[model samples]
Target: MSTQNYLVISALGKDRPGIVDELSKAILNIGCNIADSRMTVLGGEFAILLMVEGNWNTLGKLEEAIPALEQQLDLTIIVKRTEARDSTARALPYVVDVVSLDHPGIVHQLANFFSQRKINIEDMATTSYAAPHTGTVMFSVHMTVGIPADLHIATLRDDFMEFCDTINLDAIIEPAQR
Candidate 1:
């Protein structure tokens, strides 16, 4: 009997046509199964987030192959090992969406707040664009968040309210399940 290990990898670099193929093939050759993934273009960069499961014997093989692929494709690869699932119960995940005028600090501000509250952001997508004479680009972000049951939901809501006020941005935070 054997237990499998999961590795999470994030890939990012300048956007190009075949980056996905290169990474996908590399994963296949290493005998790992990509359990989940999201690949998209953001701010002229192609980024991929993948969760893959493989045996220990092949883990190093996969890790070693990444640098070669990186050099050939001019990209950066980040990989980390995931811990075994916790046996205890976990809290339900939540959703937090924010949209505002694009500014230098929008991401930084939100990230700082999320970190402070121990909110695990499972996934996030952000985009921005400028309108004629608008002077500032509009930015939109959707985040899938997880909140531990012990945390006060009201506190999270209050934090968002305060953050919104300080940034002059509109935000909505509510029970993810109604």
Candidate 2:
């Protein structure tokens, strides 16, 4: 079997209607497939991260086209070649949810907690909003972490809860749904 070539592209620009359309069309036209992507508008800016798959020649073609596409779409585009992820470690996926009064250092502290335990945080997102009824500012964090298969879940849960309690954060850790 032939090996697949991959490119990770990140683009940022002013929010506009046709950026996705134009960018996707360009990829399709270049004979590359978007393997995975995340696109969102933050404030007035549009940001996109895409992992594209193709053969070497096709991906090279896409790379050559990036400069023109950036100008046309009014975006700052970055492209990097990458290999597919290695899944040999086979870590179990777990989801962590946290809510608390809005404040700084939550993410850093949470990251430190997992890091100390040698857990890998695969994905995370955090948001802040006004709480209902009281209009109190609230923060929420959702994270997917890869736990080593040999780790004791019960002990980890106990420690995680204890840490959260000490920090005045409501949190839960559970296996990720397949």
Task: Specify the highest-TM-score model's number.
Answer: 2
- What stretches of model 1 exceed 4 Å from their correct place? 71-74, 85-89, 131-136
**What tens-digit string does per-residue lDDT give for candidate 2 at 1-178?**
7789999999999999999999999999999999999888898999999999999999999999999998999999999999999879879999999999999999999999999999999988889999999999999999999999999999999999999999999999999999
| Candidate 2 Cα misplacement greater than 4 A, ranges | none
**CA lDDT of each prediction against the hidden true structure:** 0.83, 0.96
lDDT per residue (tens digit) for residues 1-178 in model 1 = 7788888999889998988887888889889888889998877999889888889878778887888988987888899989556757476577878888877888788888888887777678888878569657789888878788898888788978898888887788765764
lDDT of 1: 0.83
Q: How many clashes does the backbone of model 2 have?
A: 0
- Per-prediction TM-score to the true structure, in the order listed: 0.77, 0.97
